[model samples]
Target: MQTFATLRTPQTTGLPARSGAGMLLMWLGIVTFYRIWVLPRLGITLYVDEAQYWTWAQQLDWGYFSKPPVVAWLIAASTALFGDDLVAVKLSAILLYPATAWLLFVLGRQLFDTRVGLRSAVAFSLLPFVSGLGLFVSTDAPLLFFWALAILALVRATSMDRWRDWLLLGVALGLGVMSKYTMLAFGASALLYLLLSPQRRAQLGNPRLWAAIALAAVLVMPNVLWNWSHDFPTLRHTADITHVEGINDKGGNVGEFLLAQLASLGPGFALAFLAGLVVAWQQRRDGRMQLLVCFSLPLLAIVFLQALRSEANGNWAAPAFVTATVLAVVFLSRLKTRWWIVVIALNAGLMLTVYHVRDIYRIAGKPVPASLDILKRARAWDVLARQLRPIFAAHPDAMLLTENRTLMAHLLYELRDMHLQHAAWKPQAIPQDHYQLTTPLGPEDLGRSAILVTQSGSAGVIERFSSHQTLAHVSVIAGPKLRREVDVILLEGFRGYR
Candidate 1:
């Protein structure tokens, strides 16, 4: 698509012809390959949260305690064909990464110059936080994709005033809600925008706008019902974590959140995001900038308020980052080429720094190391899983008990899915299936010959199981990104006639 950016006059075009759609497509493809083939097959192993989601996939629920089931369903669908290996388990997110880039491209082209559009895609593709989020099998991947789609659709609806476009916006928002409850913030923001902006408020009278809202409600109704049936446990769970419980302290304070955001978005880009906001305001004379402001402001306000309440900084307003990146592309393009090159260099430096730092902890040997000290970030459960496989294979009747989901999924894949002989294995028995060791177990549940898999971090809970013996001692790295405080350990216990 030859646009203003590809023309000979840089003043009107504002972007090099060399930085066209073809170049952007090539970058997208390379990123797709790296995420799908390079990262998953590298055997980074699942994080505890990832493992928990895997467990959810097995149960196939509409919603879970902490999030909706889209991620679980996605993982389950991918792993079913891929045979539950690391690559298969995480493949779905990798494939979706490029789609996210494409969405950002559309958003950029619509918002700014063609150069800005292509640069936005590249910026999104390379953002350390976005890249890291994309590789993992988490709700965020799907949430980001759906949110981008919603933004794209909303842009079209705002521009074209087409009923069909509004319908698409509703569907996108609905799916996003299904993906992550945080999307409710976006929904609320949209409504607030409509109510506050006189121009947008006019849409309230439009049947198509109402139809979009109705469509979104209808799509999310099933999960809402599911939560209702489950005592709205997810809402309760989120509330508990965010308010009732002190886990909020563990997530990050306001200062930490600000710092983390800065780290995730390099200093240069972060500054550019701020600058872009100013530029958008100047252009707000144009209704388009108002759209960006409307999309971004409410979410930022909510997150900021939540921060005051001790909400984890990351959770405050993650979706806002994409808008920030888009804004950055717009501002950076107007700067001298030398200055633009400096910004790109800064981005490359940040990525390389993260890559190298993550590489040191590659337990399976990195196809490409992110950095040194990666082992410090490695999770200890990886090694323990390796040792438990043979023991579980020998005693097929014996059940495995894990305190957390990550360890639980690791055992499931290692023992039941791979390595072990599966002649006629039925699903796991009760307590063995998927019990939360974070809670206590009674005496009636004791004295069973079970492989009690518990992590050192949470070993205090299982310390009282006197009837069992520690059969093996194993350890794995913490992770490339997280701190290595306590290595996760697995304890095996056998019931004895005392």
Candidate 2:
């Protein structure tokens, strides 16, 4: 095995670093312009998740029921500066991707050559997941950015054994955790790297490593405390989804998840990434290859196993791709440029299709089916809100109530100017979401009228009210290719929370 001193030595590559930096800047400028100026004007309504985060941003907290508070914090910061418009809600996502791309470029250049760095950044930017991320607000935006930063810091810390680098790695890990719980995977990979690498194993005894761990713990302490005070709802929610406790017969889920990952990464890039994984395994003796593999593979394996046991979303392994992008580019760079170019072209086409999906469907003279249109959530909210405005104006004293969290979020954001009281139904139970937890219609609301909106009229809800009447039956268009109508019923005269 190579000694630590030998492994720490940086390799000199003939690739022009200045040119690579210039290319990164150019890409950043293009992406920034499109995201900031062009995409927001395309008339895409905010998705339910984005609206939910915006609602959360209005009442900033240390933690939320479904995830930590960083995403909400980010949205809050952006909307504060830019106002609570669609562009403002999604600003963090737009801005963060360029920073993530820049980090990928720098990490690749540090590990390999300028060509690899440029390719890796481009590959990351062109990912199908990124296509969605660039226009939508979600936890993935900040999680991915910090994940890449953590990996880069990990490389520097392991290779240089520098105290400052280790401290920086801790800060990144802490912030990543704040962004999303999946960041624990990166933390696990970092631990495994320290334990497995013979050359850097001596760092185990270094106080700096322990200090880094302590620093991360300190940074996340507030969130942990918040969870404790809130009956550990965040932990419970995470476990409920991940443990698959009540789920059975997950036999096909793993296969479905793998396929979804292929689609999410873009098929061409997925194949290249898998190939790069094999090459990294074959070249494990190289310290840099080992570092990349350590950061990239463990999270994917964990999510794959989770899929086998239960269900995993395609984006569950998103952070894994941060390092995987560099790995794929490094391996693909050894091949003819034509191979990677074809992949880039395919991915670019997919991204363009996603961006102009409505236009494409309109041009084809076809109604995008709800099943095929992934962007259906970003539609219909505006229409629904407009229809509800008159009903809300008619019942000035009535509060708004919804059984669905998604509806509650959309309505909350859409009717924000009304200043009407709203709450999610949680009769005889604990809160399931931030809205329910924060806005409980208890004894004080008894005999108070409410405008109840739900997917379907519930007998239980009718029984609790003094008198109920159906106001309007609205059809919401959802999905892209094969559009579907979702019927929403508006009810009035809910007298209490019973």
Q: Highest lDDT, which number? A: 2
The TM-scores of all predictions, comma-separated, are: 0.81, 0.93
| Model 1 alpha-carbon miss at residue 276, Å | 1.8
lDDT of each: 0.65, 0.80
Q: Write the per-residue lDDT of candidate 2 for residues 1-498, one digit (tens) a residue.
A: 343445433434465789778978898788777767767645568887888898889889999989899999999999889888888889899989888999998887777666777888988888888877888889999999999998887777767778898899889989989999898888688777877776668777878888888998898999999999989988888877776565546453888889878887888888888998899889877777877888878988988888877788888998888887887787778788899999889988997777777778789998655565676657768777887888889888778887777888888888889977886778857677777777876667777777787776477776777777777776655444422233333444456653
Query: What TM-score does prediction 1 earn?
Result: 0.81
Residue 428 miss distance in model 2 (angstroms)? 3.7
Give the Cα RMSD of candidate 1.
Answer: 6.3
What overall lDDT, based on C-alpha atoms, would model 1 receive against the true structure? Answer: 0.65
Q: Write the per-residue lDDT of candidate 1 for residues 41-117, one digit (tens) a residue.
A: 34466766677677677778677767887898898899788877667777777777677878888777766656777
> What shift in Å separates residue 215 of candidate 2 from its native position after superposition?
1.1
